[model samples]
Target chain A: MTRRRLQILMPWAVTLGLFALWEAFCKISGIEVFILPAPSDAWAAGVEFWPQLLEHSLQTLFTTTAGFVLAVGFGVLLGLAIGSSTLVYKGLYPVLVGFNSIPKVALVPVLVIWFGIGTVPAIITAFVISFFPIAVNVATGLATIEPELTDVLRSLGASRREILAKIGLPRAMPYLFASLKIAITLSFVGSVISETVASNSGIGYLMLAASSNYNVPLVFAGLLVVAFLGVLMYALMALVEGRMTGWAFRGTDLMS
Target chain B: MSDPEFHPADFMKPADFMGPADFIKVDGVDMTFSRGEEEVHALRGLDLSIPKGRFVAVVGPSGCGKSTLMRLLTGLAKPSAGTVTLEGAALRGPAKGVGMAFQNASLLPWRSTLSNVMLPFEIVAPHKRRLRANRAEYEARARALLKTVGLEAFADNQPWELSGGMQQRANVARAIVHEPRLMMLDEPFGALDAFTREELWSVMQALWMERGFTAVLITHDLREAVYLADEVLVMSARPGRIVHRQEIDLPRPRTLEMTYEPPFQAHVHSLRDHIQTVREAH
Candidate 1:
């Protein structure tokens, strides 16, 4: 009981400790609110601008989710294509890696020129930044199929399509779910970067606007919301992942 | 001789009738795998014939192409030099009536034990066509097979929840679920503990006796070969060929106590001696 309780409480305790240290350091150093606001100032700003903050939060969520959905659908299909064939994997993998390495921030300007100063650029940026992990993880899952399992299927006279539907896709679930956990955060980063650079709305734009007005407390509040949403989405992914892939990582307590 | 364009299922025999080539035959088959710039011969002109419903074991030293032979027999790999035929027709792609198990159970983690056992029904024909229409019947069949392997209670259990021996039992259940004409087991019991291995030997013995599915087991253990097989084929090292064939004359439904008898030990010793000589010949 104690071990389980500790496992649950340790992360929360450390998080509280880190916040406490940061708050104490800013206050003790006699830093001005304009320079580095304490946690209390940020909290007050959050409560004061709750309605505005909530609206901006929803906007960011909408764009990020839209982009992420596109990434997933595109990633899985592309991953299946790349993983199933040696020729496709070799021919396109280098180009994909090269594209991923070129920062999505650079693509934001080009997208803005195409779509022109709106949520579309942010959504596109989010998708461009995050889709790589999903593709790579899924391809890895497909490519690393067990030789024994393949032999088992092949010797039974299973067709190529049957093998993919039955074995390849199911085996890729853990990888797919794992990639979501990583890609969701990147999507958020992509959205915020584009928003800050050239968007009319969202928490990123709000932060950029507030910083220009010297509302350091509001800026910190915006930062806090981004972190909260990132953590929330990650925790949500982890929960769904636990449910879907219980057989892979956790063996004992499984869904019936 | 190599026929690069052998057709699949071209054998002119009915699905269920006594034919001239009633059993699987590997005649003049050779396997050579390429490594970098050089070609490495694994099996050379291997010829063997297995009677229907017979239990056969192939035992040889490491790198003796035992696994290569299994791949060829199951149509996973083409023999470099010769042909493999079931009922006198050449095998091209994966054979229609074959099932295989390996040292590891290789069950899909996401599937329940029953689902894993019923996997082949979703792929192999006749069953594939009837799967959706006869879902409950297939489920019942899977449950019955699991019961045969003493895994009836674990039908809904995740594969990892089962013990190693139990997992192997599930593997055996899965292999036979499709009702293949021939079952290939490549070192299926090699990973189990001595007690578990012997226990599974009994389970397998009962299965074979009841169903009488033709079995071809590849193993390094001479004792296991002698205990389970009606005939044990010994092979030489790389570029291997069948060096000796020993027929087990001991009676049906073999018990573990038989391994302790003077005759059983004598058979094991003689086979071991031949395998050792074959290994040293390289």
Candidate 2:
């Protein structure tokens, strides 16, 4: 096969191979469903509870996407400020680092206490968790513009605002998209964490309820849905990246 | 192969006087930068002048602060002592309507070659305001210039799609498209291989002859300096100042073959000798 064809097929082959190995291991070991459900058991349970699984998956997706959209809007503005100015960057960077270092899961109860057990807390958690990467990446992109390029613009009497608008933002777009891929996954993690801690719906809550009832196969199904959603969102991000900033990846296989 | 229009009498006289006709004047200029705690003196007591529409090249060894001089001339930097003036007015900040091209092509990868050439119109005044209304006219001019550089075919292509020589051609096109009164080039062909660099010298000559803009080129290549400039200025080592000045009174539109001839070789050799002396004096 051609390299491009192999590139497309390789991931699917590896994933299928891993699932086959898992099924073989479970069969040989005669593992209990509660201890480790087989892929077949998970698939069977997923089909039986298809409606419930769909609803919960949709809830998780909604909260993650809502939170992610807000994060993108707010984080990009903060990033532009931090990146363009020395004062904002120095003042906020250490505080941002400290804030990012604090385990976001630890904030769940405080969010729950303020907002109560539902989508609100989950959305807030997702927003807080995802915004940091987007902000930092955008700032880094703006700050690292080539000096020679800056000279070309400055010599033409381009204002600072013009430079930021014309060159800095477009240059930062690839960085922004790269960070979106990371932030989207993190948003899912944040929403799910909130949901499991205190929520009536979502895949996280379903998994928690399934574990309590010893429905290990159902819990495995929930995990699979979340993983599928994360991969789908990541692929979407990569597609947008390819469309918008393909020039940044010229001469690279990534664009193809 | 000399045309009847080629005037040997004009090439015979050297440019020795500095006044009235001078477009830019740098007098007793000094540039010092504080790196960490120590003050590194880049240029000291530098004095130079360029006549209007003259193409002058500054050549020196590495770290001789040739770039510092260009910065001063372009109004990107202020001298620690003395003054840099254009026409007669002293520059307080970045000079207006200056076009610059660097060693790196520095075209925006996001913009196509045609769009990159038209970039100055988006930044420069009057033009920036008139661009939306007269975009077709401006675009036609950009296409014409690209044709002169032999890059008209690649105008719609992305900057990364072009080879290094082609990208540099676009770079030169972008620099001149705005029709600025003054142009600064910082080793604009330094990164190219010998053949490409020589090829660009002809392209550069054609452009300058057509535009008649005052140009200041900073380069280490003596041949490039001699090939492209009306006069070549050599700088001393650190705490740099002009140590030698050679007027290259060659005929217009000099060919690449002329570079191998004795007259051109003599100019290059003389510059090389001056640079050697400057390096040893360090």
Worst 10 residues of 1 chain A by lDDT: A247-256
CAPRI classification of candidate 1? medium
DockQ of each candidate's interface versus the true one? 0.74, 0.64
Q: Write the per-residue lDDT of candidate 2 for residues A1-256, one digit (tens) a residue.
A: 8989999999899999999999999999999989999999999999999999999999999999999999999889988999988899999999999999999899999998898999999999999999999999999999999988887887788878888988999999999999999999999999999999999999999999999999999999999999999999999999999999988898879766
The superposed Cα distance between candidate 1 and the true structure at residue B224, in angstroms, equals 1.3
Report lDDT (Cα) of residue A165, candidate 2.
83
State residue B13's C-alpha deviation in candidate 1, in Å: 7.1
Candidate 1 TM-score restricted to chain A? 0.96
Residues B177-247, candidate 1, lDDT per residue (tens digit)? Answer: 98888899999999999999998888888888888888999999999999999999999998988999999
**Candidate 1 TM-score versus the reference:** 0.94
Instruction: List ranges where model 1 is wrong by over 4 Å.
Output: A251-256, B1-9, B13-22
Worst 10 residues of 2 chain B by lDDT: B1-10
- The Cα local distance difference test for each model comes to 0.88, 0.91
Name the lDDT of candidate 2: 0.91
